[model samples]
Target: MWHAVKTLNAHNGYVCALIAKVARYSVSAALRKESVALVYKSHGDPMQVLKLQKLNLPALGDSEVLIKMLAAPINPADINMVQGTYAVLPELPAVGGNEGVGQVLEVGGHVTSFRPGDWVIPRDAGLGTWRKELVLKEHALLRVPSDIPLACAATLSVNPCTAIRMLSDFENLQPGNSVIQNAANSGVGQAVIQIAATKGIKTINVVRNRPNFQTLTEYLQSLGADYVITEESLRKPEMKDIFKNIPHPRLALNCVGGKSATEMLRHLQHGGTMVTYGGMAKQPVTAPVSSLIFKNVKLCGFWMTQWKRDHEHEMGELNEMISSLCSLIRQGKLKAPAYTEVPITDYKTALENAMKPFSSSKQILVM
Candidate 1:
């Protein structure tokens, strides 16, 4: 009886090894013949260092999902990252995108929240969605609602989330309260304006004058911006007239540093708080001592990653905010911002365009 049991165990081991070989062959057969991805070979010059090349699709890991890229935005952070100026840097020869929307092609056995054909977007940085395909851990992707526009969904990760956190994290804001922000023509700025509008909160928006300040102000106002002023206007003698009727804002959001940041603070009320999220001007933000000492004003910084880490247990709150914003889009209460969609074949041109001064719209790359 002992001899017979030993022979049976050996036969089962042989059967398991054969099954593994067949499974490997099946996976190899299922992979795409060729998929293209943009690889960063160096840091200093992004255009020269990054190149698109054909490579085999990576095998999915136990907690991973393979997504077929649908759309991605060439955001300012993405440009800075490729140029090695951004705070976070990935390993050399890494892929080069931070946000994108895609459809799940397959999910590993351990992934439970998503299945094949579900629309999803990156929830974290460095998954590098600027490719024909991607394999990311399930935790790094967020499921997007089907009703959202593909273009809008593609751009959701950073800008919208930033706006939501900035608004919600501050002390409870009422309808009559106001918020001031510079770079108000930006995606985040626009999102803040719309979100504030939904909450019946007024916005004091500031923008640098391009050749077309008239058109820009009108556009911002149409999106429910209560007041839109150019940077030059902030320095003008009659600046007080603009704020004569508006209350001193309790919250300020500054993206451009240097003088622009100082000007944003000037609009805040006594004891108001300023949150600096970006320094597009590449200069340190300076606040006059009088404002801090006499006014008791507070200065704070906002990094979305930090907020995400601290509020890990509040994902439900974040999702609720996002869903409400999406509802606004569905009702046609929100307008999709202007953007140029570049196809994969024209990625070189897209990269060049993304590096230029901010457009009135965003630049999207469609895979």
Candidate 2:
């Protein structure tokens, strides 16, 4: 009886050891598969609504690719989207960013367009770019060259793309032709300057008068702005003096609506075009009656998101634009805007800084 009892105890100990090993393996597997994202359950102030939580990524499908995000920037549009004031809104409990660059970590069996180690950006907006990792359909992302700077790659989609499209689609601007734009220090505005300079199309940039106005002007000039003037200067009688050096602008880009836009209209050459891509002042674009009726100045708007959706069937144009911009960056003719890098763990501070007025440096979230 004593030997039988000892044998029973030994069997029970061995079973317990096996159970313990299996439990350890399960926990290790769970730890190996992890993902976290900055999510908002409801729409309101981003600071209050945005929360970081663990996410359960779906298993890779036959046409999907797994990506690990590298970096994303906080643009005013992102803040507006988070505040529920943007034109397009994602479904509830959505991620906070619309732009970023990521590297392909894995691809499904039938995914032919991308391979592991390739870099990509969302082909369209609202892909929820703030997460550390995600699995997406192969068609939803576009490959970007890995040779460019991470900052440039992360920010390439929206601002630069918008700038190029507006410059190309609106008018047939040629060398020596001038483009006037308000909010000239903006990301898109800076891109417009560099691209226009490359084509020898002059840019007359208008920025708000700041305490460091001269310094800002010099910086913009360094980026290829042909002329940098203050918003107040646009109303002055001497504003016509700018035309003496360069012809009255044939293209006017208005990100600032209302009075600034009206003043910009006064300087456009008869029959010029003004493309409104943003409303930074939260005001309506007002065209002077005379300018529209007599000058025949055209007032129009361009939304990059809508353009992408409309061109969904034709991706070749999008790919060509991205390639051209990347080439310009490689040649040092185009550059990323000034930025401040913040870790994903410290997102609140970055959001706050991004919301501050006159905050010149772009806040980029780095994973």
Candidate 3:
């Protein structure tokens, strides 16, 4: 009887030890699967609505890829979307960012376009980029070269693409031709200036009169702008000689509407095209009937989102453009815009910082 009792006690002790080991293993596995995301249940003030939530990342599906985010830029359209003013809005309880670069951590059995460790960005805007980790279908991501700089990759899809499209699609421009643009200090404007310079085209850049106008002018000039003038100077007589250095602009890019846009139109050569991409002034783009009739200038508008929808651009074309841009970046012919990196945990600080005026640097959320 004593021997039987001793054997039963020993067996019970072994069973308890095994249970504890299983519990510990389960806990460790759960910790490995945890992730964090910036999410909003509704659209309103971004700082007020965004929340950081903890979640367990789901297992990869047959056609899905698990992405670990690297970096995302805070764009004006993102802010507008959060405020419910953008032309397109994501569903409720959505992620915050629209564009970013991510590293693939895993790929599902059926996934083909990507492999583990590949770099990718969302094919289009509004893929919920402001998260530590996410799972997306294989087709939803645009794979970029692994060797490209991460910061350049993070911002590659929007501003640079917009500039390239506007420069190419608007008018038939050749080497030695000239282009003019307002908001030349902006990301797209800067891109246009550098890109045009690379192609042997000239740019007449117009910027607002700021306290540091001289410093800003020098900065844009350093980026290969043929000429940089103040918005107020666009109406002055001195602009003609500036045009004489090149020629009357054949294509004028207008981002700031109202009187500034009209003044830009005044510089347009006969039969020129002025493309309006944004209206920061919240005012209408009013053109004098005389200029439109006498000068034969054409007025047009470009929204990158709409352009994406209408064209249905294939990946090969985008990949080729991105590769060319990447080469330019590598060779120092193109410079990525200055950016301020904010950690994901302090997203509120990032959102607020992005709205500040005269900062001169984009606020990027880094995970």
Q: Which candidate is the best by lDDT?
A: 2
Predicted candidate 3: what Cα RMSD to the true structure?
Answer: 15.0
Off by over 4 Å in 1: 1-33
lDDT of 3 at 80: 75
Number of clashes recorded per candidate: 0, 0, 0
CA lDDT, candidate 3, residue 261: 93
The prediction achieving the highest TM-score against the true structure is 2
lDDT values, one for every candidate: 0.76, 0.84, 0.79
lDDT of 1 at 114: 97
Q: Which RMSD values do the candidates have, in order?
A: 11.5, 14.6, 15.0
- Report model 2's TM-score to 2 decimal places: 0.90
lDDT (10s digit) by residue, model 3, range 1-367: 0000001122124321110000001122224475677877787999898899865566666888888999998888788767776555655556778788999999989998999999998776666688888777787787887776777888888888889889999898998899999989888888999899999899999988889989988889999998989888999999978867888889999988999999998889999999999877767798989888888999999877556645455767767777888888888877877788899998888889888776578888899
Better of 1 and 2 by lDDT: 2
- In candidate 2, the residue pairs with backbone N, CA or C atoms under 3 Å apart (3 or more residues apart, or in different chains) clash, namely none
Residues 63-176, candidate 2: write the lDDT tens digits.
888899999998888888788877666656677788999999999899999999999998877777887987778988999999999999999999999999999999999999
- Supply the TM-score for candidate 3: 0.88
